[model samples]
Target: MLPSPFAFERPSTIAGAVRAVGKSGDGMFYSGGTELLLALKLRVIHTDRLIDIKGINGLDRIALNDANDIELGARCTHNKIANDPVIRAHVPALSSLCANVANIRIRSVGTIGGNLCFGEPHADPLTMLAALDARLVLIGPSGTRVVHADDFIRSELETVREPDELLTVIAFSRPTGPVTYRRFKHGERPSVNVAMAWSLGPSGRTIRSARVRVGALGSRPQPLKAIEDVLQGISVAEVRPAIEAVLPTALGELEVNEDRHGGAEYKRHLAGVLLLRNADEAIAAAGSA
Candidate 1:
């Protein structure tokens, strides 16, 4: 595949990279080029210049802060996140998600920031991060801003980031309860995926709070607010039916698109199925904890 000739810049520092972009609206930041190169090859996106941010220092670091929040560098590859000891211990569900992203090659080269910035509907991390209540760190020419993961992606193939903005890190407080995720995939990317996070009460036997996010059937991940409301304050014993009872209505309200992934109805059905499966795993893990 041939991509249109474009000027490329590799800056050694974040500031240099930001300045290199200048005011040209046609230039785009590049990191790990998995999605960018594909889009370029397809000619779905056209840009006169490519600013490579991967050359910037410390962009691939993943560490835990004193507050126990996980700070994941945006340039961190899926392989790095998947294999990092801190990530595996603090957020194993996320590690599992990263481990299973695409095939080996893509995971090796795909940066989490680039993945989120690309805003592919069927991708995995956004849904899990939304449920995890992760905060995205974005840097632009002016300064840096933090945004909740839920507010980052506005729709399919779209995000709240301006062209001049580069996502730098993804941060989230460690989960107090077991987190679980499940996806229904007929191909490489998920057709429909579900992520559930729970906050166990002091007893560890009761659910204090929960989050349910359904993805891949629509432009972006959507929270099943009603289902979450139903699960709160319930005992572990009731986790299944409580979620299932309200799930039908919750899934109905989510915006499902009839895309190549599947028909609207089929995707909706898969959403329910994957959610139920994830619920089972989460409940079991909580019990063991």
Candidate 2:
């Protein structure tokens, strides 16, 4: 497969990148071309020009921002995040997710921003990001604004971002307790992924709160709000039975669609399995603490 002819550009500044993409939507912001180029090759998407944002300074940095949030530059590749000490220390689950994304080749070259922008339902990041309650900062010619991770993707291969806006960073607060992500891989991508995060009380035995999200079974990662509600304040020891009680109904709420991955019922079942596994990890963390 071959991509159609397109003009290439490397913009050194964010404003320059935004200007290059313009209001008419003929151009696209390209960093790691892992997703964009493949889509182009498959003729799933088209663009007359690609504005590369990798050259823009500071867009590749990963650090804690002034807002007390961990800010990951949109261009930070999966390998960078996976290998970073800060990410491993503050958000080990995220680091592990990044480390296990696709294969070594993809991890070496794919950017988290590209992964989110591609909006592939079977991908891993969205579930974890949603569980983390992350926020994405989009920069545009007009101005900049924040979008919740939950609201960023409208559907598969679709986002609320304007054509002229470029995603600059992903930010989230430090987890107050055990944070965990788990996924079932069918091949290079996940068939269904689950992410569970907790906020624990002083002794870490009581769950202050939890966020649960399931992906690869819907248009985008959908929150298991029902399951989350059940997890709040539950003892670490009781997480299993408590979550299992509501698991069926909670999985039923996700808009599961059968595809090459598997049937709706099987995938939904895997979602429950993954979530429980994550909860088990959380329990171990609490016990060790």
Candidate 3:
């Protein structure tokens, strides 16, 4: 079905875009329309106006900040991120994930900000960003605020972003150690995905901290706190064993949805498998480092 007629406005500034969307109360900021266009055509979402923010400068840049954080402009496409030298050097796992999101067409046109704003449970970037402890920068008429990635998505197809707010940047401290991601999928979207980041001690032989996020099994990416706790302060050689002891408990803590992906138990099991795989990759990376 074709979408209902709507007005389109191309704004040259973030403030202008925010004002345009806020004025209509039913307007949306448009960049890469991969998800929005499809939903509009199917009548799942209807907007009175689309405030094009592409012309707003600096929304598509990828750079490393002075603080050593990787800042990805909200309008950046998956292909752009996957091939960016800064992204590849600092967060290669994220680069690989973006390179394979959906296909070449979607990667070439789907903006990361749109993907996160869509808040799809089965999506990829949200999970990886959560593990990286990324910060999402939202700009609105009232003011600007930064939200941690885990808090950005409220539930399935829903985020904390107000209609009037614009997501301008995604920033994360460059990983201090190995970063790994693994996923299982039967179609375009993943069934279960895991992202793990470790902060190795100065000696590079012990874990100072760890972050584990399991995605696609719940409304939002969830942290495996139990596994992370066990991995902390442990030597590299003990990493796998430590995780093995707590893996089942951590997987059980996840809120799995038995949807088209698979049975709840099956998806939960896949999360464990992927987490272990990520651990192995991290272990190898540490060994070689």
Models 1 onward score TM values of 0.97, 0.97, 0.99
Residue-wise lDDT of candidate 1 within 1-289, one digit each (tens)?
7889999999998878777777666888898899999899999898999998877889999999999899999999999999999989978999999999999998999999999999999899999999999999988887999999989988778899988887888999988998989998877899998999999999999999999899887888899999899999999989899987887889889898887888988888888889889889988998888
TM-score of candidate 3 on Cα atoms, chains taken together = 0.99
Total clashes, candidate 2?
Answer: 0
Worst 10 residues of 3 by lDDT: 16-25
- Which of candidates 2 and 3 reaches a greater TM-score? 3
Candidate 1 contains a number of clashing pairs equal to 0
RMSD per model, one decimal: 1.2, 1.2, 0.8
- lDDT tens digits by residue: candidate 2, 14-122: 9989989879999999988988888999998899999988899988899976767898998999999999888998899899999999998889998999999888888
Global lDDT for candidate 3?
A: 0.93
Worst 10 residues of 1 by lDDT: 16-25
Q: For candidate 3, write residues 51-88 as lDDT tens digits.
A: 99989999999999899999999999999999999988
Q: Name model 1 segments beyond 4 Å from true.
A: none
Which candidate number maximizes TM-score? Answer: 3
Residue pairs that clash (backbone atoms under 3 angstroms), model 3: none
